[model samples]
Target: MKTLSLFIAVCIASTCYSQLKKLPIKKTADLHAFFHYTGKGERIISGHRGSYLKGYPENAIETFAYVLKNTPAFFEIDPRLTKDSVIVLLHDATLDRTTTGKGKLSDYTWEEVKQLRLKDRDGNITPYRIPTLQEAIDWARGKTVLNLDKKDVPMQMIADLLRKNKADHFMMVTVHNAKQAKFYFNDNPERMMSAFVKTEDALKEYEAAGIPWKNMIAYIGSENKPANKVMFDLLHARGVMCMISAAPVYDKLATVQERAAAYRDIFAQGADILESDLPVEVAEAMKQKH
Candidate 1:
């Protein structure tokens, strides 16, 4: 019985290690080139909320690490602050939905939040606990890029964390408009930032920001497929890559094949990045012929 138990333990440990594995991205250069429009039409994928499937809890380190290990994709995670002013990965203002805790996320101290287990998208409680921003940043070092969506934390705090971890190049912050992009660019000129450019006016706005185009990724929102070829061309002219988020349109499709075609269409429209909830599926689709 003792030997059997030891064998079981070993198997479990191996499985856990397999789940937390890293990808083949040896350095940040490959990821940087893919996002910065320098990779010669390399199509990139941003795993929405870190592939929050059945076993993978959203915004959890395990999910992010698993995606990094399995797929050639970066991830987007939401950052919130605790009552004690600690930055943590959480989507909503309250933890009642994603965690076992009650009330506002800010109501709990970091210690209290750490005790709460994360829930999968289907609402099943997982064994993972909330990870601090610094913990996530540390784990992403030289492995994968992270798009840090500014949810509840201040921009300055986020910038400081990126600088402290020396993760500016590997991580990104999403900016809604050119003004916000300018603000973040002014604060830390070297950091990577993503902004939306839906029209010619939007392009003008970004150009007016006075920041270098190399440091930004333009998110061109599309319907079922990528539109606005002129905007894409304009951005590419200035050495900027545009991302098309397929989550809003293609995620609701009934089959993977349909979604795959949609992704291919987006790329055909000159989108450099593909954002999706099904990162693994999309990455697989990208490899296959449309």
Candidate 2:
């Protein structure tokens, strides 16, 4: 048993390093052009879950339109795959967490899932059906940058869909391990994959893969996250640009005001692309305060 356990640990570590080697992270010029000016010149304010306010629906097309009109804010939506292979816009694995439907989503047909309504963060049912990824993309054709959130599904379809729709106006982000990043880039070398990073080690893994790490957005951990100075310092040294988030788990220090403050303090610390629930606040904070 002891020998077997030792062998398993070695296998796991080997698997990790091997996977990390597959990523095609870009270097110098290739990466810089992508992540260089995230939220800088563009006042693009993307709303979370389609601007989930106290009353608006989350992931609903209507809610997105409202956000686009009401504020300078753009909408951030999600794409998930159903058992039948249809891509839908949702934020949870189980519908029970954010919708009136019960049971695992994989167990239901696309039609059945569509009948269910989405709920707010507070559990109030809003009038939103699970929109297919294609439908959401079509709706926002020339209007906004569709932020695709891939929790765990491999991203081949997303690349295909983007090319099909000519929807090159949006930015995508995912939380990825080294192996996942490599596999994503390798599956289709022509496609772009964005990810979130919390540590210098993660950054190295992504950069090593030769993928364009600049346009690649990273999430700031809820706790003990590397400071922007530390983050930029490492990335700058590599000549790779980066984006920061107040996510991958929200923290008390992650208040909108604080993030905006961080945006101004170092200024450059505010990720090249600043993703926030309070897009307006961030814009005003960075534009007005700084």
Who wins the lDDT comparison? Answer: 1
Full-model lDDT for every candidate? 0.79, 0.58
Clashing pairs in 1: none
Report how far off residue 56 is in candidate 2 (Å): 1.7
> lDDT per residue, candidate 1, 186-225, as tens digits?
8777767877778888888877878678777888885634
Q: Which stretches of candidate 1 lie over 4 Å from their true place?
A: 1-32
Estimate the overall C-alpha local distance difference test score of candidate 1: 0.79
Candidate 1 residue 80 Cα shift, in angstroms, is 0.6
lDDT of candidate 2 over 18-57, digit per residue (tens): 3221112233233225444443443334467775555555
